[model samples]
Target: MALRESPESPTPRRPVSPAPVELASPAPTRHGTAALVSAAAGVLLAVLWSFEFVDSVIGDTVANNLLGHDAKATAIGGTGAGLLFAFVSGFAGTFTACNIAMVASVGPLSQAGASNRLRHHLRSLLRPVGWLALGMVAVSATYGAVGVLIGDGLPQLSTDTVGGMPVRLIQSSVVFGVIGLVLALLGLSALGLVPDVFARRPVARVVLIGALIGGFLIGRPYPLFNKLFHWAVETGNPVYGAAAFTLQSLGNIVIVTLLFVVVVLVTRGGFLRWMTDPARSALVTGTLLVALGVFTVVYWDLRVPSIFGVGWFPTMPYN
Candidate 1:
């Protein structure tokens, strides 16, 4: 009897842990490294977007003192163009960096998980990466185009002699906000992060709230999008006005960052998991896309004069 009781089926040997996934163990492909670096830069810009108070004050000062009044609005228009340039360029860089990072992280893991055919696994990754890259480019380009439209609209808005620094700052902010979103989306896709379902609703609400706050700070009438343009008319020093606009621009950056962070964190478990899980991930991605589109449309048409008012922050020498 004692002999019969001996083995106890050896506890049915616990299943062995799955083999570790192989990342891109070989030297990173040029494309993959580029993606990683670009994503890092994108992250940095996202952080810069968070500080509203300081930027606004500086903007106000620049608008009032540098560009002076009437020409201020035109300068703001130009600033928006500047931002569009910065954003699109940055977005391109980030996408490349992120793609590299994904290969470095996932390629190796896949190899470790299954040693058979490494090249095949990596080749499969290319499609998703391409899709992500294309998305990034499209979104950023759209944002820049919208900025152009808004910049063109500046002259008709108001006859005030305020600074252009404020206007420029505002235009820059709008471009940055939209461009930031594109970068964020690409980063998420490259990292194989979650799609964003769990946090989509909350993140969307936050974006909306942030937009409202930015509008209020600038003295735009609440509610209707067009009503907010009047805030471009400043009451105090040109610097103060520019500073206000800068701060308002910063507010938008902050909102985008918050949403980006939420998506990144949720997907941190694994980019593939997020991508594969349509229900959760798709919802998040879809919401972000929708939010971005709406913001672009509304913000672009809101007011052309306020951007020129940014001139109050930076006075024009020729004037």
Candidate 2:
């Protein structure tokens, strides 16, 4: 045993294995790109629509007042100064109660699930958003057609009297009053102050409510579109009238869509969670609607001049 120590003896060594290689974590999937794109498109359309609406308002006013009811004047003036006004109005509309309510209602639905993939989320959202857009377009176009008809018939009926009131004046007042009432009721319902009749069928009721509200928002009398429709009818150019309202509707669609996108982004699913509380939704929506309704009434009934204003409101021709 003592003789085993030798210079050539190698020390025993344990086998060393290579260190385990760590593969990079799988790349995270991007989500919500499509929704973002859609929102951008909606913003663009809204701007365009708002611009056109402003143009119609200013152009009609100038043409009817300054240029002696000339269609040529309207086209020129509206296309010129209208662009500036439209931008202002469009920007202003973003902060309105009706618009805010619409955003609150639709924003939650625009969200895709918690999936990390962008495409998957987009696929989920596309159908609902597309259907909403399509519905808006259909309703808007119908409003346009109605405007055209109203414009065409106004001139013939302007001189006609109903119960000692000008047919036009009567028509304007009644329409305005009725719409204001409807808006107020809608607001009340949203606040949960009204009965639960509309709550029974939430989906259909919401869509129908949106359509009615949208119709009033886009095609209200005393606005430029109404005047433009009249001018178009006088000139036998119904296309102009139709285009104006349709474009405005498109603008509304864009605004709503963009709002939905913003809310979804900001809340990050919290809005969806919150929206599940119907009572809360109703309260918020009702408050906004009430404000809008009151504003509508004041603007149309109180501010609008009874005799000198153009459009559906009865007015003496400016000499």
Candidate 3:
């Protein structure tokens, strides 16, 4: 207790002000720019896939491998044949522009997946898929039934053309346009650039995505689907249509589902946790949504329209 010790009660130190959060963060800018570029790349990829060289080669090749060369003839044998065709065709379409966007679901699925003991993880895998299938089945069954009743009256099955553009292609443009916008917006939302509509509504989101997958049939122009449509009409049975379409939707999801399972099994659910982690979830989910979403929009709307001179998409030399 020296007198010196009491002489100067040290002046209270000023609390340091936390470093200024740059009011204008570069983060948003970087994200926005990356998003734009990703979107552009999506469009380009859509164009590439649209070109005859790529589309005909990949889509047709896949279909041939899956259903043999008789895509149209193969479905004509009877109800069993038609149903089988519906499924095989849907499955084969996994790479086509109309259906490829379905792949975007992988992002949400990955984000939703949770890790646990392998037994629990394996069992848990199907829950999200079941939810997805529920959504898909509803749309597909309804559309299939109604499509039979409506026949060519449905724009998706129209034989008519407008302004020299096949009405079927026009339907593709409209349907995929909406779906793509939805996916892209979802990506933006995940990236924190928009309201998080599905943050608390994860189940609904999955269902909606499933519904979108089902909706793919609404715009699908594959030969087998077209064949199935006519078959359902000829049979005069909505039940047939509904059943076949449900199967088709289920088939459409089979490969992607398997891939999801493989990822979970191989990684022991770690990939999903890594993806869904708060830090990386948004980035991964957003990128997938934006890319696939933009691909859907461009492949259908822009690329298809270009054929009618509504716009121009680059053509590869081989085509």
Candidate 4:
């Protein structure tokens, strides 16, 4: 009995375990990410397209007419033409050549599981983009100044206005040719499927040469470029303008496609991972893009009044 009782006596013991550690997680992707990117991209495209139109038309006119008749004046009027040339030369030229930026800023938010990689890509592109932006502004400013000057003077676009035959003639002819080339190239480039080596590197050279050639073509028959210009301006319908803008933006879409590849290469995993977690991805993407859209409006509000000397858009000011 005693032995059985002793053997039966056993003690109850508890097992110990370590506490789980918590980590800070990224925000979830909400459903609105794609919409936000699309919207923001649309706005950006609109702004860029407006400038491009000006650049394509005006730059061609001025550079072409630098040795010819005052076709630039006839084609676009005075300040309008100046603005146009400025748009093409400054905004048009670079905008088409360098839209990888949108992808840099937005691709991470759009793609899945690639936030960190996207960020790195963006960082790599930042310097180039900033330089491009700065160059665009400078070129735009120069184009504007020249346009304004010529607008006031109504200088006959030819070698005499630009310089001598050796340098000026060659330069002017080259400019016209180049612009024509860019317009033609733009038609194809707008498809946006070109390889990066071609897209990023070759485009600038192409545009430079094309600008000269295109400028010559448009200058030769200022009436032709003007017809398109007239169509664009005669229509007060903002929708038509917007449509035109959208059509023009097809180039941007192509440019963006090229950049998208770069973004994909750069932002490898984070974006995809984020995409898997749609909730947080949407939230981040939506919030940032919406903010960017709002900022665009605000920027337009501040900029238009100062530049245009009026307040036309209180609602959708940027458009």
Best by lDDT: 3
lDDT for model 4: 0.35
RMSD of each: 17.2, 18.4, 4.2, 18.1
Q: What's model 4's lDDT at 20?
A: 78
Higher-TM-score candidate of 2 and 4:
2
Clashes of each: 77, 2, 0, 64
The order of the candidates by TM-score, greatest first, is 3, 2, 4, 1
Q: What digit string (tens of lDDT, one per residue) describes model 4 on residues 122-233?
A: 4544433333333233333333234333432322233243222222323323443344233323322222322222333422423232223222222221233323334444
lDDT of 2 at 74: 44
1-319 per-residue lDDT for model 2 (tens digits)? 4788578999788999999999754321111232234334333332223323444555344434543444333453443343333323333344332233344335223322223334443444454455554555566566555655675465323557655545655555555556655655665555445564556544544455456545544424433434444444554444554555455554545566666656655766455456556555555455444544544454345434333343243222321
**Candidate 3: which pairs clash?**
none
Error of 2 at 301 (Å): 3.2
Q: Which stretches in model 4 have alpha-carbon errors above 4 Å?
A: 1-247, 266-270, 308-319
List ranges where model 1 is wrong by over 4 Å: 1-121, 132-269, 303-319
Off by over 4 Å in 2: 1-136, 146-151, 155-170, 217-219, 230-244, 302-319
Better lDDT candidate (2, 4): 2
Q: Name the lDDT value of residue 289 in candidate 1.
A: 35
lDDT of 1 by residue, 145-184 (tens): 3333453255323233435434433543464345435434
- The per-model lDDT (C-alpha) reads 0.33, 0.46, 0.78, 0.35
